[model samples]
Target: MTYDISLDKKKAILLVVGCILLVVLSFFAGLFLGAMIQQPETVTAAPNSEKPKKASAGAPAVLAKKLPAKPKVRLPVKPKVKLPAKPRVKLPVIAKKPAPTTPVATKVTSAAAPAPALPAAPKAKPEPYPYSIRLASFNQFKFVLTGLSQYRQKGMSPYFAKVNLGEKGVWWRLFTGYYPSRKAAQAAVTEHNLKGVQVIKTAYANLAGIFSSKNELNDIFKRLDSQGYSPYIIKDAENHLRLFTGAFITKKGVQDQNQDLKADGIDSKVVER
Candidate 1:
């Protein structure tokens, strides 16, 4: 019986040995898987540094206990975002200029340069006889004759011309040889004590205009002096002649002059030439 029990025990021992090898291989594979997991965890923990660590069976448990739990944390609520108000800006003011004052004022000056002078005036021609007058009407022949005599005494000559006006005989009487003006003739007539004395004006062709030349006037007076009359002629400032008295033509006129003559007075006569 002992000899037959030894072969059966050897077959039982091979079965136990195969089971033990399988158990050891499974333990080493479990250890390798743990080490692989530990290597990734170590690499993740030291992202900035390069190092290695050995894996252990109890490492997962210890690491899990040391890790912090996710706390009930409320993310900082975004504070009420309020934009600040914009600052107020002020604009600058520009002052305006005043307008010009006067009507004549401008950019140009008043005393820039003087203008050219104007030309002078021409001289005027002088009058031959500066003064003259006219008489409107006259009456009384005797007064006219007597006025002629008085004019001759006052350094004047008488001219008498007659006109027939119906029943009245109109006498045009004139006096010449005024040194200044016929205003002297009118003044002489006003001062006289006689009646019906009227001043008559002489024309340019009468006294002043007719006797313009000096030699011609001198020749006329020489001829009158040769005919027994003291005739003299003189010129005034305006080159006008003053003819003086001469002898009487009629005898009755001479006697009247002699009768009317004063002590210092001379005879008035009309001498024919």
Candidate 2:
């Protein structure tokens, strides 16, 4: 052991050792780079191996077992049923009663008998006084009025009549008392001592006017005469000259004549005799 090495040989050995170390390190680095690149491929290939696959008809039993099994689903169903039919029903009928009838009575009729006749009554007798005494006649109604007043003073009710004597003209004849006979009438005139009075048979005569004016009297008298009326003059109690027209047998006849006079615009009233 006591060998002594030279400096140039030591340096030559150290160079050889560093060259070896460099070559080894380079080889290890190349190995590590190859491992890293191959590790990513292996990781990608591992996931592909874990993925599911459909089983084929011709596949092996080992592959069918490796596939996942599917779950089974079931649905519910309804059942059919049958029911019985309903029964039929019938009702009873009712009867009605009849109403009662009433009996009617018949009436009998006969002809009525005629009534008996009654007896006729007797006629009444006429009045007996039919005569009148004609007192003094006057041409003027005023004179007749004065005469009537004198006779009334002597307690005699003297009434006058108008007479148309044709050519002799109109005269106012004063009269008093009704007598049954001319003899009785004469006897009454004598008893009264009536001057210039005569017994005469007289009937009912109408006295139609009692006018104050002689002109009016003449005018009415002429009018009545022209109209087929026999008008004459008489005197009333008030000394008014009145006109007389007709001599009728009945007072009814006088009334009819008065109606005619009224129709001719001469108003007349009934004076009963």
Candidate 3:
């Protein structure tokens, strides 16, 4: 017991050494096993860097490519046109003026004309006086005095007395110194175209317009004065036979008075004064 108990230090030393070697061996084996359990990884490049190749210049011959076909179209043709013909126009011609002419004269004859004559003178007759008287009238017998008065106032008086026809109721009258003699009274009555100039005398006076021959009314009175009849003259409106007594107008008045007077066997004449 004692003997082993005192075992050798050297061996102990060797055992310690062997234990360190076993630890180191275990670390190295562990490191190699961890490496062996892991696989080895291979590395590769990017896929973009590996591309396919393009066609080469030395490929097989191919045929030329043909063009596409186009659609067919036709163009239209145009027709030709003709124009109308124009007429030709002509101009008018002008005219010329003519010349002037002269005038002519003719001849005449004188034997065909007539002649002229002269004038004559006139002749004359002898002239006389123009005188007149009214003879008598047949109405207005009642106014004999009145008539006599009017005639006397006008320078005329009754040459013969007034005579009355009693049955006829009329008067006869005469103015004074109107005649020269009986011939003058007769001539005056005939000239005046009067009727019933019974007896003529230088007694009666003249009135105007009984004679157209002369202006001798006063001249006749003067002639009667020279013949010695003192007859008075008058200018009275009532000296007519109507205002006197006998009332004689025409020849018939005197004739009727004469016949009446004759029937009574009494005669009276209407003598012109």
- Cα-based RMSD of the predictions, in order? 33.8, 29.7, 41.2
Error of 1 at 271 (Å): 25
lDDT of 1 by residue, 65-143 (tens): 5667789988888889889988888778777777866687555577677753332222333333422233223466666
Q: Which 10 residues in a row give candidate 2 its minimum summed lDDT?
A: 117-126
Candidate order, TM-score descending = 2, 1, 3
Give the worst 10-residue stretch by lDDT in candidate 3.
121-130
In the range 1-273, model 2's lDDT, one tens digit per residue, is 223457777878999999999999999999999999999998899777855776777986573345566666656665656565666566666666666666665443455555433222213333444577877779898898798789889998676655556699877777777666888888897888877777876666566655766775787778776765656555444555656665444565566667778888776655533
Each model's TM-score, in the order given? 0.24, 0.34, 0.19
Summed over model 2, clashes come to: 1
lDDT (CA) for every model shown? Answer: 0.48, 0.67, 0.44
Among these predictions, the greatest TM-score belongs to 2
TM-score of candidate 3 relative to the true fold:
0.19
Model 1, TM vs. native: 0.24
Winner by TM-score between candidate 3 and candidate 1: 1
